[model samples]
Target chain A: MHIPNGFLDAKTIAVTSAASAGILTVSLKKTKAYLEDKQIPLISVVAAFVFAAQMLNFPIAAGTSGHFLGAVFAAILLGPWEAFLVMTLVLSIQCFVFQDGGLTALGANIFNMGVVGVFAGFLIYFFLRRLKIKLSISAFIASWASVVMAAGITALELAISGTTPLIQSLTAMVSFHCLIGLGEGFITVAALSVIFMARPDLLKEKAFSKKITGLVAGLLITAFFAALVLSPFASSLPDGLEKVAHNLGFISKEAPSNFSVISDYQFPWVKNKSLATSIAAGVGVLAVLAVGSGFFLVLRGREDGA
Target chain B: MGHSYFDRYRQVDSFFHRLDPRAKLLWMFFFILVVVLTPAQAYTAFLLYLLAVFVLIRLAKIPLKVVFKQSLIIVAMVLMVAFFSIFKGSLEQKLLLIFNVTAKAWLCLLASILLTASTPFELLLKGAQSLRVPQVLITLLSFTYRFLFLISEEVSRMQKARKLRDFGNSRLKHLKTIGHIAGNLFVRSYERGERVYQAMLLRAFKGEINTYSDLRFMQTDVGFILITTGIMLPIFIFSILFTTQY
Candidate 1:
């Protein structure tokens, strides 16, 4: 689920980076205003807890197990903002120290896991609660929904990065998630039940629920709709409810979109194959050298220039 | 406990280890960009990348046995992806694609390992802080690093305790026990946070946990950055001249 470096293209990296950064800045400010000083240490401790809890492997079937993700768990305990921050911390540490994810793809990982996963759990759980759904049941459903949403978004990113066809990746990713979500749902319900018994006061804390903003809601709906449109490609639906798959099937269909720009013999406008090859080689040389000079400029050229 | 886990070779002093953290970070970042931006079909370029990373690792005085063992993770991932790619292309074409992704990923991981292994966590964070990571994030990260080992130790202790009290083989009950353990840890960690905050407040810890500034972008840093960048042009030239089917 953690996207590695070189898996995503520059465009996908840029867009996801912007989106996650925007949401996080807003979250940092919002949480800061409400919790003041105490939330910082609390968020850090919970982040540590999530890190350690990830080591807790729950048995599923024979010889296979899944670790706790804790996005939804965090959202339920602390508000969505703090949940996002905690996830960001965990994912960032995973990327930097453990190298579990890629350095460049950190933003996409955060967006998929933190923003999409956390918000999905928060909104759905509260919405279910409003309808008088039982607390444990609402948590179960929300956790399942969050995992599924995260899997779908991950497939979307891979497809957009041209790593795989949308239909195939979506089908493979979502189908398995349908089962993984069950595990997540059961564990979340179990954990919440215990917490409810031990520290009911924690469950009752609505740290920051009022300002969910239209941007987040719209992003959720759009992604959910995208998953809906793409889910038909899977061919096996459990029926009744399958509407969040996306229609991002064009990059695969386009055939020569990203690769054409940097293909083995690219810059085709020159019209001669050998000439294009030479020109491409020349450009690579010039680009590399230019970057070299740029690094020198930033690292040393400043002193001389000044 | 995990302190010794990360960058086990940080105590070793070598050329790469002695370079400024900022320079090492920027050079590694640039190296990754070049490796990733190179087309997958550019096998020669990927070879050059592997060579560059190999030279840097050796310069850092880290043993190849350790590095190769760490790289098994990336290799395993590539094998899985390659297996799935069987549906996409012919055996030869699939091999090329697999080689492409594996080489790129392996090279990136090596460069990252070199950077982190050479620089201590504090200096690395200081370098990243200079690169625009927020102070709040830096503080949280340092605290997380400080407590991660303690918390992970706590988790193992609890696991040991649970194992000692093992009863039977009911799978659902097993799952519930794991969940209860996680829930208990969460409560304990939350309270621990309050206690830690009180301690910090007593010590007049405002908001930021600061790392001292000892990093200087020196002459050797500039040389290392440029020489590596200079290596890229020839890699592409060799790649274009020899490897391409043209």
Candidate 2:
């Protein structure tokens, strides 16, 4: 998800920003070593292709449509580093030009959607291929897992920022993304099948060494199970952990003083909090769809006039 | 192609449009940094920031409708977060969360929209180059911008052709067709990339992308920055004073 400004606190933003900057710097240097002059224009063109492809919506169900995120597909087509750069460019343009994502939160957005999405997807694909899974099936699984993992990370960020309770945000983000991931999987499979049929050479060039693939797969499995084990404990007593950290002089004792503007930081104004929230969500979805479609209508009108 | 969605209002002649692209870029970065760093509780400061953005929007002479429409995506996102906040803290806290998030996001979005709406995309890229953003990144961005519309047109053309022959109501069938289109688009794009590389090579292309635009900061650019700083300093002072007392 593209986190807007104000969604994350300063600490989360700073950490993510530094992390993304580091990864991008490393990617730039690594890409420079083997990236031939002939491939320069190709890289730009490929990035534009991804940007355009994202705008191409496919019908998923009645009255609904979805588009490919292209991270997994890009990584499979290009190398992972190239996909990372393409994603970074796309996200940056979306933030700066379209205001689709927040400037302050750009680091988090890029890290979640670009770095995590690309690397996780690539790693999963690599693992599956090593296991002799079909290319189409592996692409599907990798893209699906990538979407879900990115959503989980996004929820973790929100929880760390104290925007919502950890368990609830985690569950909500993961559940909703599960459906989105299915669509992603389908699209990735469909696209990969076609490419495999037509130009298998592109995929061949990007293959990893068997030793490296096995190592990555082992690391991924370990990390996945570790997260599974740690999540419940982390969610149960976040406040307790914070308190302990504060007492140990690791963190400041200050409660978010800036939040004092709201007067009270606990308790709902309405008796039926769930109902109120659902209504608000409905209203927001409707308003956004209406405004978005209206804007497109105006744009179309201008296009016709021109 | 006719709409030029990326630079819809860049041709407009106004103070903001006339300002050096670097100046506008600086204004955008400074405004966003200030807005983000301001404590969420600083309502007065936020209001002042909003006022400043509104003034800039006016000076840019861009249509309010265009700006608001462009901003709706950010508004929608913030609203979703606010909705979640309702299920969490006290009534006051929920309200505060919504207010703080909405104000900060809206201000930042407006500042960004102003920059893009007023400055042409090419100039913005040039400004970014002058700012010494990595050369490789800028090259990717410039190429993406140049080819974005063409690829979009190609996708639309494919979609139109699909609709013409498609009689299938089945979801799976539709997905299959979309997948094929996506595959075809990718292949076409790859081919186009190769042809473009060859063309660039014929023109004595090197790894370096050269731009001919010579961007120079003028007297007014300095004056504009000074004026913005003059306004921002007081807001910063007021926010600090207001926050500390509470």
Candidate 3:
């Protein structure tokens, strides 16, 4: 869900950052070991295609549109590590060149979206397909589950960070994402159907062995669920910290910046705080160029650079 | 495929635009860490950071209009993200949480925007490569950047084709059309990837891509970092010191 900075505290940020970085390192090693040089472009291109695909939104309902996240789709086509790498790339680019996400919260955003979605998508598809479930059906369920799980994890992170209450946020997140998941499920199945009909051979590549993929997926899923189960306790633990927090009384986030006009308590020396944020708005348009380039390539692709 | 749309303000001459990419990258990370680690109660610190970044934005000489529009969307997205969570907390806490996140997120976005807006994509990648940020990641990121606009163009063209063909408004049909487009796009890009490899092989390409570079960490780079941290240190110190009140 692209948890912006200030949403997660230093503690949650550190944990998620370390965990996501570790997973990414292992993923990079796995990918390098598994694929040969000639075949590597497929991963890069698939990542490109996924990034492109995310931009093309389909109308879900009146006044609302949804786009594909493609984690499960990538997992089914390539493998989990490739899928993880692809999504992480997409997210990081979104964080860096585009202002779609927060740089500081990259780890948490990657953890919630990349790690959780990839593993969930890969595992569910792997197992369901083994159980002889239809490929399209397995894709539908796997993609759906991945979205829901990612949403749940995102909400939990928000709760644990003291940004939101767990239960309400969890319910809202899960319920809202349940709709989003339906879009994911349908698109995934349909996208898989494309490969099924046109280029099914892409699926058979040995991105990783079946046993190892399963094992890694199982471990990551287990760890994710463990963190999910334990995090609430950590936040609400009757330990000295929570007691100290309660004692301190809200620790009062205080708007975190001088842009605290909404609060009764304003930061000192801010005569017109609301007007000051105009100064803050000075850095977010490149994504629009990326966003606008879809139209330009038709005219510009003939002569691009070295 | 289109490099022209990559960085609109890269052509603009300014101090930030002229600094080393590695230095700017460091400034970004350091600035983000300060934003992230500052206690949420530290309003003064956030303001200070925002002002500093704004100064750089001014020095970069980029148009403020583009930056402002981008940040508005980010703040709105934050609001959308917090819609569910905001209802649970007290009025003060809820307002504080949203504003805090908006401020911190806005600050990080500006810095990143500044980084990308000021430097061309190629130089940025070259800087990251020199930083040794996993050769594979840089490679993949470079590939993604190159093909990003092309794939997007393909998808848009397909959308146009679908519209031209009178693909009816059935939601079911809509999903299938997108699936078909994606599936079609996948095969297209995949083949392009294969051809790219062949092209690379023809050029005596090894596992790594070596772009010619002339990046060096100059005195300005050092000055930028020192000045950033110089301003940052006291705000950070005073903020933590102020946190003792809570």
List the candidates ranked by DockQ, beginning with the highest: 2, 1, 3
Model 3, span A32-57: residue lDDT tens: 75445645566778888988888767
TM-score of each: 0.83, 0.84, 0.84
Q: How would you encode candidate 1's per-residue C-alpha lDDT over A54-105 as one tens digit per residue?
A: 9987665557666778898999998787898999999998887777778878
lDDT of 2 by residue, A230-260 (tens): 4442544544444344435544322342233
Best-fitting candidate, scored by lDDT: 2
lDDT of each: 0.72, 0.73, 0.72
Select the stronger candidate by lDDT from 1 and 2: 2
In model 3 chain B, the worst 10-residue window by lDDT is B84-93
> Quality of candidate 3's docking, in CAPRI categories?
acceptable
Off by over 4 Å in 1: A34-38, A205-208, A212-306, B233-246
Instruction: Report DockQ per prediction, comma-separated.
Output: 0.32, 0.32, 0.27
